[model samples]
Target: MTEIEKHQYDVVVIGAGGSGLRAAIAAHEAGAKTAIVCKSLLGKAHTVMAEGGIAAAMGNRWPEDNWEVHFRDTMRGGKMLNNWRMAQLHAQEAPERVQELEDWGALFDRTDDGLISQRDFGGHRYARLAHVGDRTGLEMIRTLQQRAVALGIDVFMECTVTDLFKDGSGAISGAFAYWRETGTFLAFEAPSVVLATGGIGKSFKVTSNSWEYTGDGHALALRAGAALINMEFVQFHPTGMVWPPSVKGLLVTESVRGDGGVLKNSDGERFMFNHIPEFFKAETADTIEEADRWYDDKKNNRRPPELLPRDEVARAINAEIKAGRGSPHGGVFLDIASRRTPEFIHKRLPSMYHQFKELADVDITKEPMEIGPTCHYVMGGVEVDPDTELSAVPGLYAVGECSGGMHGSNRLGGNSLSDLIVFGKRAGEAAAERASSLTERSGVPDDVLAEAEAEALAPFDSKGAENAYTIQADLQQTMNDLVGIIRKADELELSLKEIEALKERAAHLHVDGGRAYNPGWHLSIDIHNMLLVSECIAKAALTREESRGGHTRDDFPGPDPEWGAKNLVLTLNDARDGVDLVEKPLPIMPDELKTFFEDK
Candidate 1:
C-alpha cells in the first residue's frame, strides 16, 4: 500500500478560478477553515482567459438598465429554458458582486463620471459589462487572488483531485488527489466540498477553452449520485482566430464587436444584416446605418444583428462559410478599422490589437480579422439548488460553470463572469454552514481509499497498447465532427457508439514515463472525464429532437413549442453503465416576473 499524505479542513474548494476564490473567501469569512486545491498555480486558472467583461446592471452606461431589465434579457437570451429562480437571483445580485470586486482592488475602466465603464456584448440589452479594455478577466482574477491571500486561505496548487470519497451515510467525506508536480498521492478530509471546476470544452476539437476544462467536477458529481440538467446546450462563440492554424481556437473577445466592429464576408458585405431571425427581429437593427447609430444611442435604437445571442451569430457565421462567402481561411471577416478610429481601437481593445498584431501579423487597427465559431462554454453541469448551490448529495456544492440551471439553453456573453461570483459566494457560505453544522466528523472507509488509489495508479500498470494522446485526439475528432453546433439523429447515434468504444479504449489507456510531471499520465486521467461528459452531451442532444438555443438539430431545424416547455435532466442509470435523460417541465415563472415578457 502506498502511503498518502492527508490534510483536514472544514471546507475544500476545487478549482482556483473566479468562483473557487470567491467560495474560499466566503467560507473563511463564515468562520470555517478553508482550503483551495487547484490543478494549476494560483491566478493561472482559465478565468484570466476571459476577454470580454463582467455583466452587471449597474445603470452606468444606460441609466434605464436595472435588475428587472437584465433579468428579462437573460431569460430571453436563454430561450426561456433557464431556471427562473437562478436567473432572477443572478440578475438581482450581479451588480453588487461587480461593485464588490471593485471594492476589493479591481481596477476597471472608468467612465467620465468616475464610475466603472460598461461595454456591450451579444444578448445583453444594455452596455452591462464592466471591463478593463479586453483584459477584464485578468483584473478580476488578480483582485480575487490578492484578497484570498490576504485572508490566509490555504492553497494547494498543482494538485489534481481524481476521486471524491463519501461517508457511511453517503455524504461527502473528502477527496482523493495527487500532486501534479511530484505525482504524490494525497487525501483531503473535509466536511464540505465546493466544486468550482469549469466546463468540458476540451472534448471538442475546436475550442476556446483551456486544458483545465475537462469536466472533472461534472463527472465527480455524477459519480457521487448527483443529477445533471440541460447537457445538450453548449455555447459556440462566434469569433475565434481562424487564419493562423497555430492559434486556431484562440478566443476573439466580443468586446471587439461591442466596441463597433462589424461582421463581413469575402465580398465585403456586412453579412450579419442578412441573417436576422424572427426571434430577435424586433430587437436587432437590419441596416448598417442603424447599427452604427445604435452604438451612440443604445437605449433608443435597436442593437445590430452582430450583437444577437451567440447561438444566432455562430449559426449565421457557419451558414456564411458554407455558402462560400467566408474568408480565405474558412471564416468570416470582423472589420473594426472601417468603423472605429485607430486610436479608439488601440485604447479600447489593447489586448486584441496586440494579439492580432503579434500572432497573426494583422494590424487590427488598420485591417480586418478572420474568425469562426469555436466551442466555448457548456451551459449544463451538476444540477444544484438555486439558493444554496447544494447538490443532491449532502455536503457537496457546486457553482460557476460546474453547476447547471443558471444559464439554461444558452448563456449570454459577459454573464459567465457574474455567474461565478454570485453563486460562488452562495455556495461557499452554504458549504461552510453545512460543514460546521455536522454533529460528528465523518471518515471514509479504508477500502474506498484503497480502491481510489489503485484506480489512480492503473495507467502505470497497463499493457502499453493504447496511447493517451491518440485516444484523446480520436475522442475530440469524434465529438467535433458528429456532435458539433448542428446535430443530426444519425450523427448523434454514431457519436454514442463511438463514445462506447472510446470508453473501452480509455479503460486500458496506457501511459509512458514516470508519474512525476508526466503529461501523458495526466492526460490519461483527463480523457476519462472528457469521455463521460461527451457521452452525456451526445445522449441529451439526441433526446431533445429539436433545434433550440445552443443545441441545433439539423433534422428538426426549428425550436419546438413542446420541447421548449421541458428540460432534459440527465442521471446515471441504475447500473451506472450509461446516462438516462428524463424530460422535466420548466419551473413555472411567477406571475409578476412573467409580466416582463407580456410586453414582448
Candidate 2:
C-alpha cells in the first residue's frame, strides 16, 4: 500500500492559471479555506502566453461601445451557439472585472484621455480590448497572482490530480493527486472543487497550448458524471510560425492583424476578400480600399475580411495554401512591415519582434511572416450552469477554458482573457457558498483511494514493449492529420479507430527509473486524459454533420439551420465503458435581445 498524505480545504481549486488564481482570490474573500493546485510553477501557466488583450467594453476608444453591442457581437461570433446567459453575464460584468484588475494595481496601457487603452479585434463592433501593448496576458496573470499571494491563499505547485472522488450521495468529496517531483500519493478533502485546468490543445501535434493542456479537467468532469458540450468545436488560430521547423506551431499573436497588419499570398494577392462567407458578408469589407479605410474609421466602414472570425480566416488560409498560392513554407504571408512604421512595431509588438528575430531569424520590420493554422483552444469542455459555473455534479464547478458554453462553437480572440476573470470569479463565489453550506468535509473512501493508488502505480509495474512517448507522439499526429481544422466523417471515424488502438498501447505503457521526477510516468497518466478528450472531439465532430464555427466538415460543407438550433451534449455511459452523446435545444433568446440580429 502506498503511503498517502492528506489535506483538507473548504474548496480545492485545480490549475493555477489566470482563472484559478482569480478563483482562489474570490473564494478566500468569501471566507472559504481554499487551496490552488497546479502542474507547473506559479507564473508559468498558458495564460502568461496570451499576447493580445482582455475584451471588455470600456468604451474608451469609442463612445458608442457598450455591453449590448459586445453581447450581440459575442453571440454573432459564436454563430448563435453560445449559452445566452453566459454571454449576457460575461458582457455585463467584464468591464467591472477589468476595472477591478486596475484597482488591484494592474498597469494597463492608457488612452490619450487617460482611460485604459483599447484595441480592435475580430467579431467586436468597437475597439474593446483593454491591453498593455502585446503583453496583456502577462500583466493580467501577474496581477492576479500577486493578489492571491497577498490574500494568503495556499497553493500546491507541481502537483497533478489523477482522480476526482465523490461522496456517498455522488457530490464531489475530494481528489487523488501526486507530486510531479516525487510521484508521492496524496489526497484532497474538500466539499467543493473548482476545475480551471485550461484547454485540450495538447491532443494535437501543432498547438500553441503548453504541455499542461492535456484535457485533465474535461476528462475529470466526465468521469465524475458531468456533461461535456460542444466538444467538436476546437479553435485553430489562423496565425502560427510556419518557418524554421524548430518552432513551427508557436503562436504569432493576432495582435499583428488587429494592429493594421495585412494577409497576402505568394502571388501578392489579398486572398481573404475572395473567401468571405455569406454569414459575415454584410459586415466584412470586400475591397482593399474599403478594408484599409475601415481600419481608420470602423463605425463608418465595414471590417476587413482579414479580420473575420478565426474559423473563417483559418479555413481561408488553408484553402489558399492548398491551391498552391502559399509562401515558401506552405503558409500564407502576414505583412506588417509595409503597413506600420518600425518605431510603432517595436513600441506595440516588442515580443513578436524578438520572437521572430531570435527563433526564425526573420526581421518582421522588413518582410512578411509565413503563418498557418495551429490548434489553439477548445470551445467545448465541462458543461456548467451559466450563472453559477456549476456542472451536473453539485459541488464540482468549472471555468475558463475548461468549461463549455461561454464561447460556443468558436471563441473570439480577446474574449478568453475576459472569460477567465468573469466566470472565474462567479465559480469561486458559487463554490464558496456551497462549501460553507456543507456540514463537514466528505471523507475519501478507503476503497477509492486504494484503487487510485493501484492505477497510478500500474505503469511502473509494466515492463511491456510499449513506449509511452511513442504512443503519445502517434496520438498527436493522428489527431492533427485526421481530426484537425478540416474534418470529414471518414477521417473522424478513422481517427476514432486510431484512438482506440492508441488507448490499448497506453494501457501497456512501460517506463524506466524510479518514481522520483520521472517524466515518462507523468506522461503515462497524461496520455489517458488526452485519448479520452480526443475521442470526444472526433465523435462529436462526426455527429455534428455541418460546417460551422471552428468545426468545418468537408463532407457536410456548410451550416444547417437545424444544427444551429441544437447543441451536442456528451456524457459518460451508465456502465462507464464509453461516452453517449445527445442533442439538446439551444436556450431561447428573448425578443429584446434577438432584435440585435434583426437587420441580418
Candidate 3:
C-alpha cells in the first residue's frame, strides 16, 4: 500500500479561481479552518482570462438600473429558463458584492461623475458592467487574493484532487489529491467540501478555456452521488481569433463590441441586421442608423443586433460563414478602426491591442479582426440549492461555473464574475455552518484509499494500452465536430458512441514517464473527468429536442414550449459508469417577479 500524507480542515475548496478564493475568504472569516486546493499556482486560475468586466447593477451610469431591471434582463437573456430565486438573489446581491470588492482595495474605472464606470454588454437593458478597462477579472483576483492572504487562509497550490471520499453516512468526508510536482498522494479529512472548479471547455477542440477546465467539479460531484442539471447548454462566444492556428480560439473580449466595435462580412456589410430573431425584434434595431444611434441614446432607441445575446450572435456568425460571406480565414470581420480613434482604442482596450498586434499582426486602430465562435462556458453543472449552494450530496457545495440553475440556458457576459462573489460567499457560509454542526470529523476507510491508489496507478500496469494524447485528441475532435454549437439528433447519437469508444481507450491509457512533472500522466487522469462530463453533455443534448440559448438543435430548429418548461437532470446510473437523464419541471416564478415579463 502507498503511504499517504494527511491533513484536516473544516472546509476544503477545490479550485483557486475567483469563486474558490472568495469562498475560502468567507469560510475563514466565519471562523472555519479553510483550505483552497488548486491544480495551478495561486492567482493563475482561469478567472484571469476574463477580459470583459463584472456585471453588477450599481446604477452608477444609469439610475434606472436596479435589481429588478437586472433580474428581468437576466431571465430574458437566459430565454426564461433561469431559476427565479437564483436570478433574483444574484441581481439583488451583485451590487453589494462589487462594493465589497472596492472596500477590499480593488480599483475600478470611474465615470465622469466619479462613480464606478459601467459599460454596455449583450442582453443588458442598461450599461451595468463595472470594469477596470479590459482587466476587471485580473483586478478582482488580486483583491480577493490579498484579502484571503490577510485572513491567513491556507492554500495548497499545484495540487490536483482526483476523488472525493464519503463517510459511512453518505456525507462528504474529504478529498484525495496528488501533488503535481512529485505525484505524492495526500488526503484531507474535512466535514465540508466546496467544489468551485470551473467549466468543461477543454473537452472541445477550439475553446477559450485553458487545460485546467477539464470538468473536475462536475465529474467529482457526479461520482460522489450528486445530480447534474442543464448539461446540454454550452455557450460559444462569438468572437475568438480565427487567424494564426496557434491563437485560433483565443478570446476577443466582448468589451470590443461594447466599446463601439461592429461585425461585418467580407463584402463590408453589417450582416447582423439580417439575422434578428422574432423573439428579440421588439428590442433590436432593424437598420444601421437606429442601431448606431442606440449606442449614444439608449433611452430612445433599440439595441443593435451586434449586441444581441451570445447565442444569437454565434449562430448568426455561423450562418454568414456558411453562406460564403466570411473573411479569407473562414470568419467574419470585427471592425473598430473606423468607429473609434487610435488613442481611444488604446486607452479602452490595451490588452486587445497587444493581443492582436503580437499574435496576429493585426492593428485594431487600422484594421478589422477575423473572428468566429469558440466553445466558452457550460451552463450545466452540479445541481445545488439556490440559497446555500449545497449540492444533493450532504456536506458538499458547488459554486461559480460548476453549479447549475443560476444561468438557465445561457450565461450573459460579465455575469460570471458576479456569480462567483455572490454565491461564493453563500456557499462558504453554508459550508462553515455545516462544519460547525458536525460533532466529529469523518475518516476515510483504509480500503477506500487503497482502491483510489490502485486506480491512480492503473496506467502503469495496463497491457496493450493506448496513448493518452491520441484518445484525448479523438475525444476533442468528436465533440468539436458533432456536438458543437449546432447540433442534430443524429450527430448527438453518433457523439455518444464515439465517447463510449474513447472511454474504452482511456481506460487503458499508458504514460511513458514517472508521474513527477509528467504532463502525460496529468492528462491521463484529467481525461477521465473530461470523458465523463462529455458523455453527460452529449446525452442531455440528445434528449432535449429543442433549440434554445446555448443549445441549438437543427432537427428541432426552434424552441419548444414543452421543453422550455422543463430542465434535464442527470445522475450516475446503477452501474456507476454512465449517467441517467430525467426531466424536471422548471421552478415556478412568483407573481411579483412575473410582472416584469407580462407585457414582453
Model 3 TM? 0.99
Residues 411-512 of candidate 2: C-alpha lDDT, one tens digit per residue? 999999999999999999999999999776669978889999999888888868788789989999999999998999899999999998998888788888
List residue ranges in candidate 3 displaced over 4 A: none
Which digits, one per residue and each the tens of the lDDT, describe model 3 over residues 265-381?
Answer: 999999999999998899899989988888767766488888899999999999999999999998999999999999999999999999999999999999999999999999988
Q: Quantify all predictions' global Cα lDDT against the true fold.
A: 0.92, 0.92, 0.93
Compare the candidates by lDDT and give the number of the best one: 3
| Local accuracy of candidate 1 as per-residue lDDT tens digits, 467-551 | 8889889999999999998999999999999999988888888877887989899999998889888999999999998998999
The residue pairs in collision within model 1 are none
Residue 72 shift from truth in candidate 2, angstroms: 0.7
**CA RMSD of each candidate after superposition:** 1.0, 1.1, 0.9
- Judging by lDDT, tell me the better candidate of 2 and 3: 3
**TM-score per candidate:** 0.99, 0.99, 0.99
Off by over 4 Å in 2: none
Clashes (backbone N, CA, C under 3 Å), per candidate, total 0, 0, 0
Which window of ten consecutive residues has the lowest lDDT sum in model 2? 293-302
